[model samples]
Target chain A: MKNLKYLISLIIGHLTVFKHIFKKPVTLEYPEKKIELNDKFRGEHAFDVEKCTACGTCQRVCPSFGTIEIEKEKDENGKFYPKNYSIDLNKCIFCGNCVQYCPFGAIKMTQNYELADEKKSTLKLEINTLKRNYFDNIIDK
Target chain B: MDYLYFLYLELLHKWNLPDYIAMVTFPIIPFCFVAAALIVVVIFLVLAERKILAFFTQRKGPNRVGPWGLFQTIADAIKLLCKENITPEGTDKFLFTLAPLLAFIPVLVVWGIIPFCNEFDIISFSINSLLFVVIAAIPILGILLAGYASNNKYSLIGSVRSVAQAISYELPLIFVLLSIVVLASSMNLKQIVLAQSSIYPFCGYFVFPAFLGFVVFFACGIAELNRCPFDLPEAESELVSGYNTEYSGMKFAFFFLAEYAMMFIMCAFIATLFLGGFLSPLGFYVGEKLIPNEFLANLSVYFEQAFWVFVKTFFLIFCMIWVRATLPRLKSHQLTAFAWKVLLPLSLLNLLIVCLIKAVL
Candidate 1:
């Protein structure tokens, strides 16, 4: 009787696996295909240079050290503006702390997540690249 | 084969060549045909297994090499051919070099023993069924030599487990084969196929009488092939690729070729012993009924017979793949225990039932 049960279970197992052959595959062919990300998905950061007051809040709130850097210079009107801003993607863990803590909402995460690079130095996004990211992704959307 | 021999004789006579030359060259014709067929079939069988297994797991298999991944195995073969041969230090150089060839050559010989169609049994003899069993066991020695020479602990363990598995499984396998021999009443493979022919083709199949034996033989054949669930010899998770661990390049390719080729031949063997070999299950040959020309119809029957053999063999192969996809690898102790405790007794009972059926018939 036990052996009969085992045989029946084996048959059921085969039938279960056999049925899966008709089901659609869940694989996304990388490069040519991409998955739809959620609205709050945190990927590469987009920066609005006009809204940023060179506050350095993003650099302070970042969990990974040296991930965000800002250089500020006072203009003739005595308002601080960023001389240079850069984000080292190697150090940034995509934790969304910078996006969460930014007072001016200048730094936001975009859905452009294909960030692989052959060289580590090339992954550092300068001010121009980050602003372009905001224009290409945020403004266009 | 006789037709080919007569054609050769006519050509030789016209060319003013010796009769002995014709005799010498005639055997090469069949050898070339079998070798070419074996290569093409093994290549396609690899791709089929990959595609089927991919579908079973809900994934797209190799579709990059060519259309529908048709040339994937061909590209792989070329890569293996071009790769550097790596023989590790502290290994026995001679045995390491010879083991893969020793493993591969017997499978080629066994392919010649199978009666594909009525007129195409290249190496048929009265006791060719027995010959198949004897030749099939030699690859185990090659595996043993590979493990002994490799100087690796995992290879040694894998080969030892393989020998143990083969020994335990061989008994039940022989008992199953014995029941088949009883049903067919002949040791010649061609005669076995002829025995399965009747007005009702399905009822004449030995599978009806010795269904238990068929199950046992299928299990034992899987074990013998070192396929999944019984694949202790090269358990990838446990032993890193097993006996051919240190082999690379064309040497490893030889082992790969031998394995898939053995799988095809084993399925073909099962089709012959139980599923009625090259006999059409339709009760009548379609070619004989449809073809208008008498000589063409006679020729088409041979092709139709070969087609039936392939269809049955591939069906069995699909079942084997299904079993692979469903089952987890058995523990080594459970493998031997199942063979001895379960399969042996079942096969004996199957033999008894087959004898009763044969007597009644």
Candidate 2:
């Protein structure tokens, strides 16, 4: 009776696995097919230049020291704006602290997670790259 | 083979060539055919396992190499060929070098023992089924030598487990084979197949009478192949790839090639033993009905026989892969216990049943 039960379960297990053959595969062909990300997913940082008063709250609130750098400058309208704002992504741990603690809503995280690069210098996102991330997210939405 | 020799001799006679030339060249044709067939079958079997396993897990398998990853194994073979052959230090150099060849060569001989179709049994002889069992066990020696030469504790342990597994499983395997031999009343594999043929194709299969033997043989075949669920020898978590751990590049490729080739041949052997090998399950040959030209129809029947052999072999292979995908590795003690306690008695019972049936018939 024990052997019979074992044999029945073995057959059941095989039949269960066999049924999976006809069902649709859940794998995405990585390069060709991209997975859908959540709306509030924290990926690469997107900077809104228009909203920034350059108070450098993101630089202070960031958990990793030196992950975010803000260089303040005076524009022709005499308002503070960032001149050489660069985020060293190598140090950034995607903690979302900068996005959470921002006073002026100047920075946000976008769903642009393909941030791998060959060089450390390339990984550091500059003002232009950050601005592009913001625009890209907008276009994505 | 006699037909082939006659045709070759006739062709030589037409050209005023010597009969000795035909004799010399005829043997090479089957050797080349077996070698080519081994490569093709092993490559496709690897791809099939991966594709089928992926399907079982709800994932897309290797679709990047070629259309549906058809060239994936070919590309892998090329990659293995290009890699440097690295022999580690503190190893017995001579035995380490010879081990893979020792493991692989026996499989090539075993492939020839299988009667593929009516006229294509490459190395036919009386007691050829017994010969299959003898030659198949030789790879264990190569594996044991590999572990001994590697100077690695893990490899040694793995090889030791393999020998134990082989010994225990071999009894049930042979007992099942004994039942089959009794039913067929012949030890020659070709004769065994001929014995299975009747007016009703499917009912004529030995699988009907020796169904218990079939199940036992299939399990023993998996254990002999050291496949998944019984794959304690190469248990990745414990042994880090087992007896071939110290081998790399083309040497490692030989071990890999031998394994897949052995799997194909083992499935073919099972198909021959139980499933009415090369016999059309539909009770008639398709070529005889479809083809109008007598000579072409005769030629096509040989190819069709070979086709039926492959179809049955691949179905068995699919079941093996399914078992692999479903089950986890067995505990070492459980493996041996299953063989000795569970399988041994079952196979003996199967033998008794077969003998009684044969007597009654």
lDDT of each residue in B1-361, candidate 1, tens digit only? 7985897799899999999999888988888988999999999999999999999989888888999889999999999999999999999999998899899999999999988899899998899999999999889888998998899999999999999999999999999999989988999999999999988757899999999999999999999999998999999999998988988999999999999999999999999999999999999889999999998998899999999999999999999999999999999999999999999999999999999988997
- The lDDT values for all models are 0.93, 0.93
Segments of candidate 1 deviating more than 4 angstroms: A73-80, B14-16
| Clashing pairs in model 2, backbone N/Cα/C closer than 3 A | none
Docking class of 1: medium
Instruction: Give every collision pair in model 1.
Output: none
User: Relative to the true interface, what fraction of contacts does candidate 1 keep?
Assistant: 0.81
Q: Each predicted model: what fraction of the native A–B Cα contacts (within 8 Å) does it retain? A: 0.81, 0.91
How far is A29's C-alpha from truth in model 2 (Å)?
A: 2.7
lDDT tens digits, residues B110-222, model 2? 99999988999988989999999999999988999999999999999989999999999999999999999999989999999999999876788999999999999999999
Q: How many residue pairs clash in each candidate?
A: 0, 0
